[model samples]
Target chain A: MSNRGPADTPPSEYEDEGRERLSYVVGLVLALLLTTGAFAVVWLDLLSGGAALAALGLLALVQAVVHLRYFLHIDLARSHRDDLLLILFTVLILLIMVSGTIWILYDQHIRMMA
Target chain B: MTLRGIVGLLAAAVPGTASAGSFLEPAGPIASAQFSHFGVISALMLIVIVPMFVALPIVLYRYRRGGKGTYRPDWEFNWGLEVVIWGIPVALALALGMALWKHTLEYDPYRALGPEPLVVEVVALDWKFLFLYPEQGVATINLLALPEDRPVTLRLTSGTVMQSFIIPRLAGQIYAMAGMQTQLNLLASETGDFIGRNTQYNGLGFATQSFTTRVMSPDAFAGWAEATKAQPAALDAAGFAKLLSPSVVSEPVLYGRFTPGLFGQVMARFAPAMVQGHGQAGMAAPPAPHQGHHHMPEAGR
Candidate 1:
């Protein structure tokens, strides 16, 4: 057999290493920006009441996505399909429990008001 | 096969001092419905639990080291066994969820059980419950009186910390919180004395924070109300201030007269604006004649 060594390694692995390091820096910047933006909206009184709430909620969603993509290395790639499906299933279960609780409480509230 | 016999058997099997206060011996429609719901849920859970328990010893003995049981070392997976293991629990859970949802709606505590409900304002203090009959213009400490077959609405609030008000024989527990009001509607099916208590632990006197609930005939209830109104004790601002101090009252105290709008005053202490608006609206609206008597005077500003 011919010599099989580091020379035989694919070029994509080196590119992947660079991209992986870069992804963490990018994720950190995005997370900090989102957090600062949320704090600024409240501290500087940039938004009020429901608008402020909506902005904070949006920033939180984006931050979650950044953490998942960079730290957890979860994405739409075929190799990550199992992890994505697992997260979706967990989310489904959470939504069912939370929404069911809210629905029951709200219905009880309405009946009490009546 | 009688319902009484079944309930009796269940009560005997359960290791508790069964008394008039027992939810297992429900005295009202709501409590009875709750009891049935609990029974159904327990039976549903046992469908899975009982079989696993029964099979444990049998499987252990048969598959022991020197036993003559057939063993398949190469066995990996079987579709039939997988279906049996997963399918039953999923189906049972779905059924249980549907049942719970249906019953929760049907037996909502706030839902009026009958027409002409007697409205009582309940204030849970540090270690006692004060029941004010808004309609009857009387109040009592550590006692609740109701007319059998007639619906009774209790509007509850907590003067100190949060507490849970429950008369297990008559209904389930509903929370009482400071600054907020919760409502419970109940109707007694028969005349009897039940026990009501604050289930939430608040302070040193939590254990003795219980009241007697007397369900009597309509005529008897009216007479009791009239007699209570004739008592010498009056609950004014001074008396109320004394009550605010945490203490366990050994005997039920009856007040011949209470300051009008006392309940509103308690509510206003925490949420002034909301209580003011509510009090004003209630005063402005003309009372429906068909509704039971309401003697609430103008709320203290």
Candidate 2:
């Protein structure tokens, strides 16, 4: 507990220079724009039916990726290999769950309709 | 599961209408099938769950302070054990998936049945069912009538939010999503009032989204249709708008005549022709070129 001293700490001046204040502002604005765009597609009923559904789905997928990359600071260089593998596995599992649900339900549709 | 929790779950799932000589049995085919599937899955999981519950105490006892057992600190993953663990589930899922696939196809309602059963277009709204008997040129809201012993095919859609079309005695609960059609086939063996309701929760009026399904003799059904047609006015576009207006506990209303191709018009309102063509392709004659060309890769390009 007694080993630390004020002179051993790095100055705050170096940290401030590395931070991109302008890029942070731009990233925030872009994120807001993407969110609004997603909302507009849904609110306007732009696609309707299957196309509309797929479009909204794609929008959500892209938005999730964007959030992970930018806001969460998840990237190839910054993240460990295990972290990237975990994310990939998680995405694969999610896809399997969603697609399997749709497939089984569609089959049920065919049967119930028959 | 505790007895209290299981009781609560059952109570929550079963409707209050069960004791009133309800139209359909609460624990019918779909409910039973789902229950059986869940039971099998849970039973298999219990193989691990129960053992863990038991072995956990034994492990704790053996590993206590100053315990007699020797410690092995350098343990690696057991590939054989992992293979056995994953293999058992994969095999079980494969068997279950196959069974589900076979049963699902066998019960397909829209497939061509004997003599092409009667068509009933059902629209579930806030708290009622609007049944349009296209072939009979009749429409009824909050009341469904069908002749006993005849296969009845229901084409279901929703006016707004998603709903589930469930007739417990007849078949499974299939979702009725807005602007999207889902089909169901059912036949009543005995003549009676069958309960039809929206199984999925929508909004405030969801509790009352129920209707009476009357299974009548062929002669009685014809008489009922005649009586309905004898009403003062027929259902038109404006009339439809009025019927579609969200309301609670709507009274049964019937119309002798409905606008021609009314269902198709409703289908087109939210979807392009190509979307409609997806379902109607094999059922009816090919859709018109201009309408069907909306999303087809060959034509859209």
Candidate 3:
């Protein structure tokens, strides 16, 4: 809508600063780096089993943060609280569903007679 | 027929198998515990279903066909009814979940049941069950006999596709997978013959893939084990290959002896081909560990 900001600055100057094109490109490059690093570690056999899994998990967490901060523009500011709250709720529900499914199925897998 | 006669008929009809195909007629310790769990869960589920079944008829009769059962057009929501509707199922689910959690840990498959439980390695082939008693150096087709009162652990794998090993009176089914091992621990409480089979279908012969489990006393078992050593059939690699040729074993087979460590090799035989899919051509597998063990008794061969 209106490209208006602080009275001290003109609208055109403020719009250029707030566009965040540089931040998004940086986020995209970082996400690709994390993904490629994880894949290379596995492909090159740098780590095996649990170590490789943990490394990939760490990289994925960082990439997710990059997406939220740069692409989705989520922040701690009061103006973005509603969107942040929705994301938090979605994550909570997702964690509950995935964990509950794993708990039930893994329990069956371990306890069933073979 | 009289009640006693009917009961007698039912018992005899299922002879050489457990009394029932369901856990209700459990013949072993594991199955008995599972049967109890089934009963508990069933009752908990009825907490939801039974009330609905009873209420449906009463509500229909009272409200329909001009039957007057005190009309309350102004009624909205009753606090007591609301609490009853939601509270009961939630309470039942919590109770059932706790029970499941406790028993699940208690009956974990990998836990060893006793100090010296008999180990039976099972391979589910096309339409038959091949049970190898590694410790005894014996193998059987379509027959699994064990000593009563001793815990038995079955290390199960599949030679072909996946199948489920189930002995209804003994324990619930667990899957048998190729190229991997799974475990089941159970113990017979009393001497009885029970039915065990592959519960998952693979091919045309799947329907008849049943086997018999005879639980004899320790003395009888020792005798049977000794007698098995003289069964005239030696379960060498060639004999085993013949066994793998996809035929239904209509009768029980006994191999007086099996090559030591044969079970491990049988498990390994699937690995390379499964991984490579080269039609087992010139795979050049090294001699199996059991094949090396054969020199212990026969010095010349």
Which model scores highest in TM-score?
Answer: 1
- Please give the CA lDDT of all the candidate structures: 0.82, 0.67, 0.76
Task: Itemize residue pairs with steric clashes in candidate 1.
Answer: none
2 or 3: which has the higher TM-score? 3
Chain A: TM-score in each model: 0.78, 0.69, 0.79
Which model is ahead, 1 or 2, in terms of DockQ?
Answer: 1
* Between candidates 1 and 2, the TM-score winner: 1
Candidate 1 per-residue C-alpha lDDT over B1-301 given as tens digits, one digit per residue, 9 for 90 to 100: 2554576696889878467697788888998888888778877899999999999989889988887788878989999999999999999999999999999999988788888899999999989999998788999999999999999999898889999999999999999977667889998997988999999999999999999999999999999999999999989988898999999998999998898889878877876655444322321112212221222233223
Judged by whole-model lDDT over C-alpha atoms, candidate 2 comes out at 0.67
Tens digit of lDDT per residue, candidate 2, span B56-83? Answer: 8988889777776667678768999899
Tell me the tens digit of each residue's lDDT in model 3 across A41-91.
989998865566678778888989989888977777734678888989999
TM-score of chain B of 2: 0.69
Best by lDDT: 1
**For model 1, what fraction of the real interface contacts is kept?**
0.05
Task: Give DockQ per model, in order.
Answer: 0.07, 0.03, 0.10
Candidate order (lDDT): 1, 3, 2
Q: Rank the candidates by TM-score, best first.
A: 1, 3, 2
Model 2, position B170: C-alpha lDDT score: 59
Top-DockQ candidate index: 3
CAPRI-wise, candidate 1 is incorrect
- Model 1 lDDT on a 0 to 1 scale: 0.82
Question: lDDT: which is higher, 2 or 3?
Answer: 3
